[model samples]
Target: MSGQPNRKFDLALTGRRGGNVWTIDGEPYPDANPLSVQPGDHVRVHMVNHSPVVHPMHLHGHFFQVGDAVQDTVLVPQHMGEVTFDFIADNPGDWLFHCHNLYHLDAGMARVITYVQ
Candidate 1:
């Protein structure tokens, strides 16, 4: 996001054995570690996938600019693949950001974006 995002987050996606925990930034789901933002804030998420599997990242409550298109979900290929998306935090609430893959999500890959006052 060369437009200079007001809020920036770097997320890394990976998987851990023994419970098959799908992790974001190296932690399981219900991480309780939310990304805080304000309404109208320009947010950018730079995501990198370290696993050898594709991940379709989804953001609830807002559409994001990926490449030249605006969509809520974008795919990040495996093996160090990266994706950068930008969005305006217009919705006010706690939204989930996670992999669209039901299995990965059920395993533990997710985060909450909390809109703070």
Candidate 2:
């Protein structure tokens, strides 16, 4: 879309009894999917909920606009809600992105997106 490369990616958040688990690129995240990016690249995160409960996604250090929230947290309803977020990989470093629920993070529903040199 913009000057940066427009890449489409989908992440799934599955709800469990107490928390949720996340998957990226068809693999279990954190231990499996390590986000890789380059400077100027535009990434579109299409977060889909596969579980029966709602999940609020959050990204640290970067402010994203999904609807109107200036902060990072966004509410995604169960099994049907999907949030589309775009960001320019200008900051070259590793940034954490995941569900806002602390229990979800403990349940492996978190990941780090890295912008390379």
**Index of the highest-lDDT prediction:** 1
lDDT per residue for candidate 1 within 38-64, as digits (tens), equals 998999999999888899999999999
TM-score of 2: 0.80
lDDT of 2 by residue, 15-111 (tens): 5564345543335556866677887777778887877777788887677655444557888788667888777667778888877777766667777
lDDT to native, each model = 0.90, 0.70
Worst 10 residues of 2 by lDDT: 18-27
Could you tell me the TM-score of candidate 1?
A: 0.93
Query: Model 2 shows how many backbone clashes?
Result: 0
Off by over 4 Å in 2: 1-5, 19-29, 67-70
Clashing pairs in model 2?
A: none
